[model samples]
Target chain A: MADFSLFSRRFDVKRVPGFASVALGVFVMLYMPVILLVVYSFNKGTNLAFWEGFSLRWYVQAYHNEAVQEAAFRSLYLALIAATLATTAATMAALATTRTKKFRGQMLIYTLINQPLMVPEIVTAVALLIFFAMIKVATGHTGMIYLIVAHTAFCIPFAYLPIRARLESMDLTLETAAADLYASPWMTFRRVTLPLMWPGIVAGLMLAFVVSLDDVVITEFVKSAGQETLPTFMLGQLRRVVTPEVNAISTVLMAVSVIFVAMFFVLTGRKN
Target chain B: MIEIRNITKVFGAGEHAVTALQEINVNIAENEFFTLLGPSGCGKTTLLRLIAGFEHPSTGSMLLAGEDISLLPPNKRPVNTVFQNYALFPHMTVAGNIAFGLEMLGRPKAEVAETVDRMLRLVRMEELKNRQTSEISGGQQQRVALARALAPQPKVLLLDEPLSALDLKLRKEMQIELKRLQSETGITFVFVTHDQEEALTMSDRIAVMNAGRIHQIGSPRQIYDHPENRFVANFIGDSNFLNAKLGNIKDDQAELEFAAGRKVTVPLHRADLSDGEVSVLIRPEHVSIAEPTGNSHELTGVIENIVYFGTDTHYHLKLASGEAFMARLQNNPSEAEKRAAGDKVAVLMDAKAIQILRD
Candidate 1:
């Protein structure tokens, strides 16, 4: 038999009850809803709150729904285009801020790039809606372009932060040495700066993709008629009725977000 | 060859401005191993950077091989630099780093490879050619930096305290290695360092600077034996300064009077010795301790302490007027018991060994 005294000295049982209860409460509060939704998506019962038995009927229904399929494809397409555009703009902004000497209005430019993160999303959505409406009235055009523009604007800060941090932490002596070794300014950037900052760029792109993919409010406000992204489509379906098919669609979106975040971690984790 | 004329570098504007270099002028000869030696913040590295084209002089022109290249950027100038930190690209292998300069010059692929192999052999780093920069040791990194800088065949090379980060033994080894490389390549080298020993060991000529001003420029022997001012004398080696007054000036010598009515005749290197007040400088090794030898110019002092360094010993003495001075003596076994603390000894000074410094 193990000695009770040694075990008591090594392990503190007095605080276990309080700590364990707090942890359990947090876990249930955070993950319980998602876990319940996923479990009920397999329920044979049509009622979302009650499970009759295990089955894949909701999953099959979600796959066969033409409206859900179209919405998912649209969301993916918007995310890809917006993420690329945002990352490209963010790279230029990061380089301008970090690579050059401090100049007048530097602080103002930094604040402008990060304004979306500080201001409420609802305000941005309403503002973009009014601005796009005016443009449509002036030009008589309506398409997915308005939604893409709004999402890309919102994602710029997410991409800018990581790229700026990477550039700041880089050793400037390497670049100077490259110039001393007969490399032109453009060649130095192409050969030295790009290779070292690639990981940060990839991480930023992935973060923007995930953020744009999960957006709902901005999409709902900026998107024109008949341009319902997956989240907006899910919201519409929920208002009309409650079904496990909605849970199935949400599970797929969550999985894609998880994969993107994982890729970001792996890309930025390597030793330079 | 490089010529820097009337160079001044001010760091900032208005109240925050700082003068890093002021009206500096230097002419480094072709294939010369010259050095800019000073303490930190003395603008030695700034002067080197100006020559390397990394910085433009505020009010000066830099001529390279008789061509005005002051406005040319570093990439367009025929110069290379070995940064103090080695600055090896961590993403590249040793061979890739050494090949970078040649490749930037648009050399053919086969020529780049051959030059890379030659550089690897030059630094004795052929075995580590495929290793990443982070995987190499500091000394090895230094070798890679040197090879990388030399591979492009630049007309001039600038080294900014490249050996300061190395260990003592390795630094000593690299000092000789650097001298050998300079001679082998016959490239003009403008080395910067704060270590007096390193400058004395490796440089063919050195310019001593202080407070953004150059005090003297000469060969190692001239700089060590005969410094122009108190700064250079104190900076290069150990010296004892005695406050004195000039008594009379001859054609090639001068009479000086120290405190306690001590007078001595010293040779002058310059014809104009008319200054009334002067400071007499003598190296510690030049002073000797002996008994009264009927020499009127000799001064008596009491030994306060004896510091025994393995090859030599320093005797700290207090003179009659309470001024402290030091004399260095060889620590031979036969002379081991010659002097001790509290002993009275006469300090001997040779007329040729004394330097009269102008204030």
Candidate 2:
């Protein structure tokens, strides 16, 4: 009937000139390397730079390699422990920050809880490396606990954000209603708050798990001599040899992180 | 029964302090439906929160059935509230929500189930017992909230504008339902609402509040028929305020001289009555258009506007003194001849219906 559009078609982000090509350019810039890596992972040739015929040779080799198996197991174990610990601490922090009435220094508390996310990853890695180095020299013990603790600390903010959002969206009066019905604080949290924020918690847990699983910087710096996670092992392997087996391990890791991230978005995007 | 003695609530501290309620003293009798009636931000909800144990008074104490409950937490108090937004737990079924309070009180499984069944029957929500609270309509959620609050069998039930979220028809229905539940359960109800009609219709006694003070406290009829001051009179209903000159005061009556030299005798309810310069309040329904042969007691005014409300018609009039007045007349076939706008009419006020209000 009538054109009531506020801006001309040229101003529309999707309809602007070269929008599709620019979008394609961005996609290629972001994903072309990963796509090439994945493509070469199926190559029958030993070189990662050239793809010969299609084959699952590297996938089979990655599956059978003892170093790959051990690093994969270590990555999964570290992610499980770190994600669980981070989610627990994040849930408590989210509740403390969202449930109580506004007090002095609340903004400061928020910034402190999210310190890792705000600071550069390299800075955190160096800080943790130096801090843990002293403890290693003092106790003469260097175990996976250092890596788990570092990863958990880094994942706290990732887990905290989604849970805090969920807590803030929740109706405060529901908790009041629970208390009005003679429910103690613990009972109210268990019966009302916990059940309602379960989706956000699950989303946060998945996000933290994915974050811990794919982390390379902190793991590289904090890990001991022999305790190489999957990512660190792949990094060492790349220095020694240019092979598609590392590409295969990377594709598997990418697949896992994508699945978990998809699930995270689904959970957090839920209306209720 | 609950007693609030010299209760005052002040929010914040030092320079930012705000007095929400000041020197409030009210004693609610057992099983009586007492209402805290006021506009929003007038501290009505604050008073209700104090009584529900959600907030402790900044000063003074509260007693529930002769026991001091001033320091008790909300969970420790034997009271429940139906929040304004219903606040139904979205994760729980209706029956589960209704049964939660009992389970928390350490009631036996059989008793909790029986109580939940009874409450569901009480609120007529049996069909939606298994449904999640998020799936229910607003009215149904309101009922579930009521049932959940009442299932605890508290000594008193506090409702903080619980019907405000429902549509008009549902609000009316729930008003009647709330009144019925109050009487049937024999528990005291403390309801808070800004709607004057709802307060007048359901309250056994109403405490009209304003600016952190209780202006008046009485039965509905007493508050409506004999409001103590200007705020209560203006807040409860429509009124025509006229400047009158007080002549003489008897034991409980006074003579008021209005415009057009119309003098009428009115009952004096307040002890602050003076000899000159007073305001007189007359309800629209109490004033009528006088016939052509009206005498000295009639006031001369021109009809400014006529608003027809199906059941009744309100005639807006401008008096000879340039003051505005309204007269409501019921629409009946056998009534007097209809007066149009710009028509001159003699206004006759019932002497006893005129109320003397303090400034």
Candidate 3:
């Protein structure tokens, strides 16, 4: 038989020429700076550019600093509260958007929920600064509530995407079956819908936590005096003196983010 | 028992409105295996959904055992449905899926456990009761779905094409299994399927529907032997429709004149069949190929194509009147060896077996 083929016998798309080199170059450019920062966090000398012998002196110094300890604790506490609230709101919003029939202004509701991710971080930070300024003047109080609310608002879309995707992929007939078997709407959600999408919920929570913990621009603009989150505290330390201690803190934050992102992938990749 | 009266369901708004079921009225008896059979997009599934309370009628009333249930929610209605995809909970084990309904209904723990065990045994899945639903095969999932829906012991069980996903052999096995389960439990089973053979084999009464309207509802023999209209006759089984002229009608017998100057006195089935150009339905199995016998009831045709099935052979013939026809002959090696393509044969049909179809 003749070689009846529709495909061209030219360069293979699977194994493109010089593609491996380009990909290697991209990865090196992306990770080289972060790898250097991690390496300097354990350097014996205080200089960041020149690495002496490897030592844990900077880690010990960062550990002993009371301000760093306080800021780290506050960062964790804020992330926990904000992520919990954001995940709850996002789950409800996802259900409302996906489970019901489409209506007028449904697209508008989606746009508003994802507004934070679309707007520039600096713009949101400036808007929050002005809004919180008015609230502070009226209440005459300065508390962590303002920062928590701002973080929760910004983290909702980060939590919503995975959960909505999970719900959309789910078999809707399962819920209908539950109802047919005499389960109330709430009971059906609790037994079938909730457990089926539990992985997505957990992934959303982890993503929101990581995003809130890594935020710096909004924290820089929103925090009052003496209310320094870990990111803002690191910024202050960098301006006064650049040391391996700051690299140590950055390495720790990066480790936390990497762990969370890895877990998010594992959870969302799981098949139902 | 279920009674559906004047049920009409319309989806969407004015210009885009699509009528799914129109003026559907059915009264199902207790413990009867009723089937809604049709082609896809024909209101069979929609009517099943309406009975299961997934989709409410746009205008109608439904009563379950003398109680009005039209406005009741699905959770409040004493009904259960086995979905087409078997909608088993992926996270739960087979036993857990079976026990969910009893648990939701707040049965005692011991009773729920007892019912779950009985259901597992009924479906013969006791060995894999602890296995997750996703770990099982498609046929096993179908059994689990049946067990789960039957565990609740609802007043009515609605099955929406539950055997469609299985292979041919598995589908056949599940069809018999479903019939056995229905008979064992004595629950009113309302099954929905587009497969005519499946409906005929399992259902005590089948409602043949098309274009959101039910053409006929009767027993399997009634539907196959005497369909009220052309749609019902064509949908239930293989039928050859032929044009004929109706002559004088007296009592229940009418004179039907076919092509080639052939005429027969067949029993009239419809009162509205007037003496004019009309259509007649003849089942393939009712017609037989024979040697040319000079009888008025015989129509001569030349065999154009011959198809051999394992049990029967289909003879596609071109009649002398220039019309195509088909006749099924059971494979009998003693006499079947004599027939071949292009052989002139007489297509013999009984007068009582000929059904005059209403347009």
Candidate 4:
């Protein structure tokens, strides 16, 4: 017997089984590659194979390689700078776009800002190469500056999406109340809006950092000399020869990336 | 402490132009609790925004403390608003929320802490200082909003239906608390509310607005006893509008001729009565079931329906002239209750209690 009333509906008791099967399928598909990577990272075999024996030799090798270590450090350095600059600019853009009434070119500016999100990464890479070549031809300052610029531009739309979402979710009344309480604009942003917006900024920073760190196409097009990020360095290595050391470095990169992502989730979880 | 002169807010323009507020002029003293009472879309909130410095007037100037603050940003003005949703910062604790404004002023640590403590105590929320804002209850959130707004020590506190979010019992409790807080703080409180009972019970002076204009402004008793126009009379409280004509005026009493070809003397609020069609307004409570007495006008009607509520009884009656009337009677069994469904009843009202209004 069914209790057909307005107060009662078809509840999750009947729907959970279907949802569970779909969720289980999704989890299996996503986790299989990750599981394989983790399992192979511990393998003692020279070739990546079914587990022969467990050993910490690859981890040791990854830590000991000077080239690998240098590449990793360079990637981190560029990512930190890129993430900071990109997230700052994105936060500003998000604040402007999300919190204001319509103005001339606002919709156009919004579309332009998010254009990088839709356009292929290779297209952006080519576009950056062309733009920097023009800048290089004009100013004759061709160096890592172009690479940083390209990387930051690519990371901005990503960071902007999350930060803008956070800003939009926040109540407009709190800032208005802050203003009413005699707080100056700068003070209100620093105290009320900033603390409230911290999680979004952090999440955006982490995401931008990871994107910049992992990007190979933009770095390949923009880098002139001695400006190879870790992903580009890894690409160069893979083109030359395959090594157990390469797998080890890949595992290390994955680990560090996972840690940063976990930290992002932890901080952002407070809002939920 | 506030004077608004011909303030208006026009939203958009051209094909989408909408006038949100008309020429609104109002004055509030230093410690009076003024309320803008109306239904939704009556421009009450828009008027509040104009006074709060959030929205600049499209025309005319607003003066606070005799200074034109019409062009000032909200941060530059000494006015705080408790929003309808309370709008407490979820990131901050109650104490942190209270201290944020003072911190923005670059106040010293000890002074800010002391002020925050004082405000928490003022709202009787000192015990919840350490709790996260979201962890606290809604009532506590509202108190935190008050404490935070008051920490800056603004000249006025604007509340936008601050109690509309609460349940019935809690709403009653908060209304009393808010009135008491207003008296204690001596800060000018400008409240906007749609609930007429809330406006009548809590306000020192109520301004009833409709269609972007002030319909009437008076104390609760004045608005209830004497509404200036038909809209104010209908909106402020319940009224049975009986079609009547003004024949002549003698002192406070005026002649009201009903459609049944009977003339009765009724009280007129204004000294000057323009000769034409007018409506005679009488509250449900004022129309009694007693028989005709001295200085009373009597009418015979058949009771169409009688609704017995727990606290009060309602009688729906139809007169001989085909006009309908309703009367709310307080439940009392000691006096012989004469009204029942389809029973013949005589509705009586004194001449002094009648109000003449527009057609």
True lDDT of residue B293, candidate 3: 75
Among incorrect, acceptable, medium and high, the docking class of model 1 is medium
* Tens digit per residue, CA lDDT, model 2, A73-178: 9999999999999999999999999988898999999999999988999999999999999999999999889998999999999999999999999999888888
Per-residue CA lDDT of candidate 1, range B1-359, in tens? 88888889989889999999988989999999999999999999989888888888888898999999989999998899999999999999999999999999999999999999998998889999999999999999999999999999999999999999999999989998998899989999999999998999888899999999888999999998878889999999998888888877878877888873478888888765695888878899997899866566668788999999989999999987688889999888887778789998888877878888765
lDDT of 4 by residue, B40-82 (tens): 9999999988888888999989899999999999878888888
- Candidate 1 fnat reads 0.88
Kindly report which residue stretches of model 2 are placed more than 4 angstroms away from their true locations once superposed: A1-13, A49-52, B270-272, B291-297, B334-338
Clashing residue pairs in candidate 1, if any? Answer: none
lDDT of 3 by residue, A129-213 (tens): 9999999999989999999999999999999999999999999999998999889999999999999888989999999999999
Of candidate 2 chain A, the 10-residue stretch with the lowest lDDT total is A4-13
The second chain of candidate 1 has a TM-score of 0.97
> Interface Cα RMSD for candidate 3?
0.7
Question: Positional deviation of A32 in candidate 4, in angstroms?
Answer: 3.9
Model 4 stretches astray by more than 4 angstroms: A1-30, A50-52, A130-142, B105-110, B250-252, B290-298, B335-337
B1-359 per-residue lDDT for model 2 (tens digits)? 89999999999999999999999999999999999999899999999999888899999999999999998999999999999998888888999999989999999999999999999999999999999888989999999999999998999999999998888999899999999999999999999999999999999999999999999999999999988888999999998888889978998888888965688777777877779888878899987786545576668888999998889999999987899999998889887446778888888766888888887
Quote the lDDT for B212 in model 1.
94
Runs with alpha carbons beyond 4 Å of true place in candidate 1:
A1-21, A49-54, B292-296
Give the Å error, residue B130, model 4: 2.3
**What does candidate 2 score on TM?**
0.94
What digit string (tens of lDDT, one per residue) describes model 3 on residues B56-164? 8899999999999888889988898999999999989999999999999999999999999999999999999899998999999999999999998999999999999
lDDT of 3 at B16: 100
Output the worst ten-in-a-row residue range by lDDT, candidate 1 chain A: A8-17
